[model samples]
Target chain A: MNTKTFETENQLIRAAQAGDQQALRELVEQYSDTVYKFAFKVCRSEDDAEDTLQDAFLNILKALKTFNHRSNFSTWVYRIVSNSCLMKWRKEKRERWESFERLDNPEERIQDSYTHWPDSPAEALLSNELQEKMDEAILDLPPIYRLAFVMKDLEGLKMEQVAQALEISLPAAKARLRRARLFLRDRLEPYVQS
Target chain B: MADELKERILNICSELGEDIDSADCKKLRQHVASCQDSSAFVDSVKKTISLYKAYGPNIDHDTSSRLLGKLGLD
Candidate 1:
């Protein structure tokens, strides 16, 4: 949600909790696209994103009464959506940190030797090719790291709020964000240079 | 860059958290100015994030409506 809408979010929450269907609809309408976009970015599959969107909203409605406002509403919703994504893929092993070994050695690419992109990010338009690379890089991250990266870097959440949403320590959230960022930077190196 | 310096640069880049001009990032800004590799690495990381941010996909109207319908809010 935008900052202006968030200024009045508490009032909407209070009304929704009081069984006000209109207030509840307002919340759903405002957050549905945000939730779905986050899910799609993290899940990377439209089908999975849709399923997560439904599950997250249902969970949010069920748990709304107990929401004590400790974390802001968007953070709470992110938590629910993250949990829904995690649950869907719990049986899979997602910790793939070892795959990052190839990109770990920044020492090899010294100051003069660093790969320079042909253009700055601002000058570069969003080509379909770069978009695919971005999607592929994000998908390559482990789910835990993906969640932290998405919430902080992509969704523009604060570090503390990201920790709250992911149920991890502040430092742990920072670590995940770091690894995810470096992993992506390395993945896009060749494409940007090319 | 040494391992220690590289680690420090990466940490500073990630923890800067989109607020490059914040007071906390003063040391990072200074370091990037002096160090070419760190600057490139930091710039690339920021670019990676900016690219993703620029290309963010929105939930189509029909999909969002279906979600609301499933929740009985439609």
Candidate 2:
């Protein structure tokens, strides 16, 4: 919320709105990395992520003129990218999904031993096994919930911002986040706690 | 641990959010101090989030450049 930063963003938006190609490019460049990372996390495939990124910016380009600027530019960008991701991938069917009741059941979590996972050192977190498990766990989530989880947890957006970006009510967003976290925690339990 | 205690502790942990000083979080911590299952569950969930938060893989340089080209901005 620095005044200078906010003013600079305002300037950039005005320039882009006025058909300044350089301004448009600066806008894209500033957000491209974030967009790509988010797309990758949601789509969980390089090809899909790339396509989503391209589709997202194309949408941004088309909508920039009428953007009304109601939301900040970053939130607007996230909204577009999240929509692109859902539209592109939500149709794919999964073999099965863990039910919410099953995930929340205490009986399902009752392991004989109650040891916690080791402190995840940076090395372990960056290791291939952990990364692959995280990727698989994310992909296993239904697309909508996956988007919510990625936005709130991985991207570190606030709960309100997540609801805004996803066009959902705050409680709905929180529900998705809680379930997504539960699913992921269960998937990772054997790997970490064992 | 009784199933009731287990469920209560996990519920508290889930609702804790990021406010460590909140009353619910304080209660959860107090319960976790005496409950191994609660302690393990909290630790593992925190670990899961931290692990995935570290799993960011960027688009390669070539891919980024190609994106710009596709957009006719290069």
Candidate 3:
């Protein structure tokens, strides 16, 4: 839990529940960057991320009155965002599975994200170099491992948050992260030497 | 490239609990300070950190406004 929520967050929660739109807006705005990032990362598409973002807060707002203020607002929102994003991910995964005919041939369908960072970063060359290596490394991870690594390492979430978000146990989170790191290390070894 | 060292660092990254211990933070800091000693190793570390820093969306105000609007907060 962050300090902002620790000290007198109940006031804001009350304000939000009482129909203070700005309070709700402040809360959403503060967390939206992270939310949007996560949505985009999971969906790998702007349209989907946009939809995920809208869907998340709309869900939150609809249930705002009944929301227990005991948990941190950030945690609550992370729960919402993660649920929505994972649902989208599951949908996509399902689509891919259907297309693959079965799960055994996933390697043939794996998206090789070459040149992903070239157009996505402030400094083109460095971004391209790092992202090329990084994407290859991350894409090499298994489904569970990639999700854990992305949630913890990429999104700066705590292990507890990752476990909570993914609805898995803490030890499960740790194992996946370990798997991701080993996968990345192997993928990155040659590039790091260059 | 000992499997053990790689396993250890990966464990550190994996065990990123909500409350990071001060000792863990200190160890990370120490590693950071010496990261530049080897280009390859530094690059390896940089790949992960840079990837983490790079994960967010490059969204615009138009999209933001639309999202906010849909949330009824615009």
Candidate 4:
């Protein structure tokens, strides 16, 4: 199923690479949700995510002609979005640092307030409350870990693809993903066990 | 011993049923099934991943259109 879709996307990419404006538009439309969702999760802010989305597409357009097709188009786009998000994060962090003299204590940022779970563990795990908690937990992860988690687990990218997108080694990507999953598992253990 | 096995199983299980198709994945699945703790850990991680999979945040149609227009591609 996924392989067929990937092949189709590759065909469209080939067309777009040949200067087919319609094909390029179609590609953007097809990948918009994917890029937007990934951006939203990684940036943890809708506005920043939107900005990243815009910047990514613009860069994709500029680079489309030079695209060597060495990597999957989706992987290339992910790399673009990842870079945009990181740039936005750094810019924001710098601005924040200039505005505020001191950073908040990291210990204070931990979320320890637990919600009561329902009687059935299955029911509790499936509940919207748990989903919200999980979302919050994902957002709370450190930026690199969160990106690894989002790309591998949420975006359903392959580990190799995640590594390529992040410009990291395969082992490094796997380690980050493992740590991210462990952190999430530990955070949600109470609700899952309840 | 079980804790280490569970952790190792989890690291492999995370990539299972997805793009991974290695012999290691098959072996890990068999091991996870035989062990109670590893089985539960696999199930929990699967559930956690499913929640993330179900999260669909669509980019508004207008947003895409606006982006295209801004890029002079429309």
Best by TM-score: 1
Model 1, span A52-125: residue lDDT tens: 89989999999999989776888889999999888876754344334555655332221111111234555366
Residue range A35-124, candidate 2, lDDT tens digits: 988987776667777888888998887788877777777888898898887776545443223443454432322122211122455645
What docking tier does model 2 reach? acceptable
Model 4 per-residue lDDT tens digits across residues B48-69: 6665565445688787888888
Which is the winner by DockQ between candidate 1 and candidate 3? 1
Docking class of 3: acceptable
TM-score of each: 0.80, 0.79, 0.69, 0.73
In terms of DockQ, the best-performing candidate is: 1
Clashing residue pairs in candidate 4 (N, C-alpha, C atoms within 3 angstroms): none
Give the range of the ten consecutive residues with the poorest summed lDDT in model 2 chain A.
Answer: A109-118
Best by lDDT: 1
Candidate 1 CAPRI classification by DockQ: acceptable
Candidate 2 — which residues are off by over 4 angstroms?
Answer: A1-7, A91-129, B1-27
Every model's DockQ: 0.47, 0.41, 0.35, 0.29
Local distance difference test scores for all models = 0.73, 0.70, 0.62, 0.69
Of 1 and 3, the candidate ranking higher by TM-score? 1
Q: List model 2 lDDT by residue over B1-74, tens digit each.
A: 45455445545544566332357776768756686776676666667777666645577788788888878888
Evaluation by DockQ, superior candidate among 2 and 4: 2
Question: Sorted on DockQ, highest at the top, how do the candidates line up?
Answer: 1, 2, 3, 4
